[model samples]
Target: MADATADLAGASPAKLTTADGRPLKSALARAQAKARRRAFLLVLPLLLFIVLTFILPIGQMLHRSIFNDGFAANMPQLTQWFVDNPVGTEPDESAYAALAADLKSAAEAKTIGVVGTRVNYEMSGTRSLFTSTGRKAKNFEPPYMQAVLEADDKWADPQLWGTMRQVSDAYTANFFLAAVDLARDTEGKIVQAPEDRRVYVMLFERTFLIAGLITFLCLLLGFPIAHLLATLPLRYSNLLMILVLLPFWTSLLVRTTSWIVLLQGQGVVNNTLVATGILTDDTRIQMIYNQMGTIIAMTHILLPFMILPLYSVMRPIPPSYVRAARSLGASSWTAFRRIYLPQTLPGIGAGALLVFILGVGYYITPALVGGASGQLISNLIAFHMQDSLNWSLAAAIAAVLLAAVLVLYWLYDRLIGIDNLKLG
Candidate 1:
């Protein structure tokens, strides 16, 4: 009808006009643009808030992951020396002279700590070497190479020079390499970290492994509960739903600590079994402060996420469909497999993805109950951020985790079609 009207309007000698004698098409276009502008104005505050709180911080994190100028900014002469020389260049007397000048200047300016920290990231224990040397660099005379080496034997190491060269510039991928348990040799070739120091990769693998287990457990434990809730009558379902959501009202710390009280060696679970004569007190099972603890606590916390989505999808599925299949000479299992199960796939996917993502990043519950064995990569990231003050490396680890999540989302979207995801 609209096309026919347009044809008629085109064939007509007189152009279409509004009541105000303006062209109708132009008037409609103007009204649409005005409406769009009004809508944009209405949402402007929300857009600004998201940009400020979410987008900007993520941008800063990405930037920090690649750029750090603590060393280059403070040690100008040494950084200039690095720029002038090639990768394999050996530091001669001139090099030590430049280092001595920078150290003395950095010491006087009180920026020696910053310079030391950047190098310390690459070569641990060099922070004190730089600071201690900086204190005495002012008295160093000609033949400065001898003076510097005499002050600290570490100053003579070629590997230390290679590291200083690496951090000479404001930007580098070394932090990212360190995040994955890799580092560079004195010749600038990348290689695996020492066996004892190869930790980040292992932590990353453990993190995903635990998250996958948590997601599977949540699905396993939640599927029956969700089905029960969906099939039960309204009065009972509401009561059950309140139980499921009750955790959300309580503090997460409280829930985790409560689990600690129940799962510890002498805690409620062990005491109950001992009292019931199921097990002796000396034979109590070790449940807390290990991978099992992390898995159990996380599964309980994330179970509601799985249930709500499954329940939402399941509630709308008509019981008659299953009964009809059963009446059509199919058994209950066969009917569910052929009809009911396929209907809940969206909820399963949504819930699994939600629980997995949350489990991957969980920290507090793991910290309280996980102990040494259950700690995840986030704990290492926190260690870098809080204890070590290595914000650049922390940001790099976070960036890698975010990249992994995006890759998972991409693969899920490719295989299952993201449009099918349904969350309550």
Candidate 2:
């Protein structure tokens, strides 16, 4: 025993080692690093896919919101003149001369219309000014200010000069300001847009209000169905779930068209009501092609999203808790309110966020059913993209919508924790 003790005392501590003779700690770290690298390699394709498809498009839209070169690219000389001169400077002879040279060059290049169109967005009726001036540009001699003003007396207007100065820069916030129904006056102070042009803010408010109503409707209609499914046997619940999922199998256009048929003035519902003597033919309700149609169609379409989440959260909640509460003299309503309803909140948050986000971005249903007054902000964004062809304004509107969604998502994360969002 003494010899063993002396041997152990004399021996150096045995270092922990792997089979390959490396220290165990180092081996474990290397293994962990290798596993982490393998995991990252497996996920790299998805990351690249998201960056390319989602992140890159959003970044491009954001860049387009502030960067436009219609005036700068076509009228380089005038752009440079604006750079040299400060805002609110009255145009002198040199400024008019620079404008004359730029107009002449733009006319020759056939880009005068492009520059005019760019300026027309900011100051209505200026496209004609740019085009007409370009047409008579070569006739102007020295002392071009007076000669140019002779072509159009409107050129002498300070408001026109201010607008030109504002748009002369290659980058601007005017599109964003316009998106929010604001504009910069000749004095360079931000002000409310003209009352007639103040539509975007109203559209945004309408969009949010409608989306909230749709979310609430979905929750109200879905909660009872979800609770029934949760309480039912698997056989019955599966049959009921098929009813909920049937809408998903149908095309959205087909469903929307069906609603149109059902809701139109002379369509099925009105005809049935009239036949039943519930309403006179002359007093048939006008339902389709309005806000009411949009709400009914969207609620039906989004109901499953609410039902599935609520069902998933409720299924795991044992009935014994409610039964125990009832046995302890609690009323059914009290047991549900205190012991059951709170548990389903995670599902409520998940469903409401999903439905609200999707509803805000809805285009087809609203476009088809929602008439002039019923139209939402997304409709205007599409109008700018397709009809107006003002892509910068479209980008600005889209950027604002995207920002609002991100803010709501951040708020949800803060309040409810994203980890609690369970779809199943």
Candidate 3:
């Protein structure tokens, strides 16, 4: 029975083994495993580097989007007031007195202003109410709620105070709510933006449009160049390939600045056009500081990304396929179209995807070339970080960008099959 049990256990063979029936019992097997372990250990530094440098920062940024404390942290006194005031029909004088004293303290300390701004973004006119009460509270004596009501009857509405009570949580979905230009009601319902503030939805639409246009332009401009480079003799193709890669040697800032210089009214392009009498001086195209400038610069920058992928793909396709099509009585264009284009579709899809993905999150090129009307979503992200000093809002925008990238990647993988992609 013990022998059978030992045989059953041994029936599961070792993972590493010699060609013969013996398992990996020799020093060579041990040495191989040791080498593999050493190889894994060698890569450990890179694994830790990626986790610490890339993954942790992204995780932390995403966390901040829903982990804000602006309202709850600053308005502890307000929350205490609400808790002390029971479900009674009338407001209690004792709670009201405490609230008045606390409001005065919050005003002087600027905590009320902080909470007020957080609330006003959701509930309009809340800032004015907070500031007015906080600033003027020092003059009011005991029974200050009555004095507060006398100053602004809005305080007694209960609706205003109820709204305040509803939003006393440490974490909120406010940033995500504002991203799509909606806000939550007192009952935690999604509602459309107020008429005057309906800009974000339009901005989101504009961002997608710009990204799509850039993708189209990259594909169109890149396909022909990639085909030529892939098909031509090595002597000539190598020279052309150098030109394609030359842009990478130059600084991106330099490239953007060069576009600005060339495309501006008093710049080289307009000057050349006017001098050539192609158009009147008054009609010199106003290209810079506009959407057109953004498109032109971005297309130039991303075109190479499209070309490289397509070129790598087309180079490997044998010339005999086109020759065979022609031998079958196909015209040159027909042979190229039927035989060549289908083959290049994989490359085209890959190039288009790469360019589109990169173009979506572009910030520097757009910021430099694009004016107020031309700013991409990334520019708005930068604005939240710099001007508003709202790190949570910035993180929310970044999270949205990341989610968009993930969705695009998922759709691409589903539609195109990343496993079938051939880099060469």
Candidate 4:
């Protein structure tokens, strides 16, 4: 018996083998490794697609926000002068000489316009200053300081010089400052933009305000509809679900245009109200092309986003829990607050986050429906990208918006555990 016990101890579990005479532990590990490899292979294409499409574009946007070489690349002489001199050092004779050389060189190279436009971003009306000066800078005589200043007295303007110093670098945060309705003065001190020039800040505020209001409206409007879908018979629920999802099949333009037609002053809504004596023709509400229009249209469009998440969560909650609470002497509101609402919290959080994000980033809806006051930050970003042709400023604004969204996301994660979010 002692010999047998010793034999059993020597025959350890690690030494065990499978029926096929393979080591059991190694065989199980090999199977697990193969399964992991298969799973990775299944997801590889999605990983590549995300990196190529999403990650690369965001990386490019961040790079573009701080980089613009138009002035530095075209006006090498002036860039070198700025490099040699520290910030706040008054420009001397060599600065003027370098300016003259660069202006003349840029003129000859036909890149003076590029340099001027770069400077023009910081100091308005300087494009013409550079263009007109470039025309005479080529013929400048010695003591180029006097010569260049003589060509254009605007060159003597301290603000103009201050702006040039800031723009001399190929990379700068001036664009970002401008995006936030702030700017660095000639002395390199940050200051608020002039009242008339301040726009982006207000638009950003409006964007967030509208996004929050829309999310609230969606939650109010969507909650009951989701409950109906969750509690109704399967056949009826599926039909109602189709109605909810029908918007996704329709073209966005068609839906937006439909709202325009319905809500416009002379459209069906106003006409009906007038005919019903609810409103006079002259007193027709101005719903389209304003904040009301944006909110109404956006709420309708994003309703499905709220409803779907809610239904996904609410559907799985057994009705008996709330019923059991009621049977135990809980009032209807008490049962709902204690038992039902807590379970729905995950869906509410998910839906609000999704809707708010989509609302903040929405562009085409606001652009088409939003008039002057209704315009969001996205509209301003578009203006910089398409109309003003200041991609750096646009990128800066986008980056700021992205940061705001991230901070909001962080707050949400802190307030409500992100892992609690229900998607299905």
Error of 2 at 295 (Å): 0.8
Can you tell me which runs of candidate 3 are displaced by over 4 Å?
A: 1-36, 80-113, 124-141, 147-163, 422-424
Q: Which scores greater on lDDT, model 2 or model 3?
A: 2
lDDT of 2 at 382: 95
Q: Which tens-of-lDDT digit does each residue in 1-424 have in candidate 4?
A: 9998888679977787899999878999999999999999999999999999999999999999999998999889888988888887888899999999999999999999998889988888899999999999879989988998788788888888888888888889988999899999988999999899998888899999999999999999999999999999999999999999999999998899999999999999999999999999789999999999999999999999999999999999999999999999999999999999999999999999999999999988888887877888988888889998889999999999999999998998898988999868
TM-score of each: 0.96, 0.94, 0.84, 0.94
Candidate 3 matches the true fold with a TM-score of 0.84
Cα RMSDs, all models = 2.7, 2.6, 5.2, 2.4
What TM-score does prediction 1 earn?
0.96
TM-score between model 2 and native: 0.94
Highest TM-score: give the candidate number.
1
lDDT per model vs. reference: 0.94, 0.92, 0.81, 0.92
lDDT: which candidate is best? 1
What is the per-residue lDDT of model 3 for residues 149-267, given as tens digits with 9 covering 90 to 100?
A: 77777777655655566566667787777777787665557888777877666776787789889999888888899989988999999999999999999999999999999999999
Per the 3 Å backbone cut-off, how many clashing residue pairs does candidate 2 have?
0
Which candidate, 3 or 4, has the higher lDDT? 4
Listed per model in order, the count of residue pairs whose N, CA or C atoms clash below 3 Å is 0, 0, 0, 0
Q: Write the per-residue lDDT of candidate 1 for residues 20-118, one digit (tens) a residue.
A: 988878888999999999999999999999999999999999999999999988888989998898888889999999999999999999999999999
Tell me the lDDT of model 2 at 174.
98
